[model samples]
Target: LFVAGPILLVELYPARVEFAFYRMSLCTKLGGLCETDCLTFKEKTGSCRADLTPLCCRKGKKH
Candidate 1:
């Protein structure tokens, strides 16, 4: 017998969706289209202020 566990979630957009909202796990202090081109982490301070994180969100689309 096999048991299925909770699925993993990520900040990824569905390929089928033409216009989808990109999401981040943690809310961004910066507003508007949080890009993920650059991300930085500081384990010493237990803080991460990357241009983006590993979280995705969903919003209503016009399609």
Candidate 2:
């Protein structure tokens, strides 16, 4: 018999709202998955940042 392991829960958001502050409010209720010690999602904003880009996880790197 095969057993399943813990599943990774990923949340999907609309392109228009992914990095919006309003949507971030809802994330707080979800325990803020980005609080992990590993890599995390950060809102990329401003001229220096890429618009609507989702940060990718990297190995051997501390968030």
Candidate 3:
């Protein structure tokens, strides 16, 4: 007979959007380009995404 004391299980979610946001990688994936500084940009027309590295500069004007 075999006996087990305890077991731990962990599950990873790859389809989740929340987990998809990784550094600046998500920027281009979201149709936005990554920039060093948004203020230094020529256009300065787009906005930045939350908690993104190198600044995820989104295209189009703000509403």
Candidate with maximal TM-score = 3
Worst 10 residues of 1 by lDDT: 38-47
The candidate maximizing lDDT is 3
Report the lDDT tens digits of candidate 3 across residue range 1-63.
Answer: 123322211123333334435544666667767665654433333333434434666655546
| Each candidate's clash count | 2, 0, 0
| Alpha-carbon runs more than 4 Å astray in model 2 | 1-19, 33-63
Q: What TM-score, computed on C-alpha atoms, does each candidate reach?
A: 0.16, 0.24, 0.35
TM-score of 1: 0.16
| Model 3 residue 14 CA deviation in Å | 20
**lDDT by residue for model 1 (1-63), tens:** 123232222223243122222222233332222333323331121223333432322232345
Error of 2 at 22 (Å): 1.6
CA-lDDT, candidates in order: 0.29, 0.34, 0.48
Ranking by lDDT: 3, 2, 1
Q: Report the alpha-carbon TM-score of model 3 versus the true structure.
A: 0.35
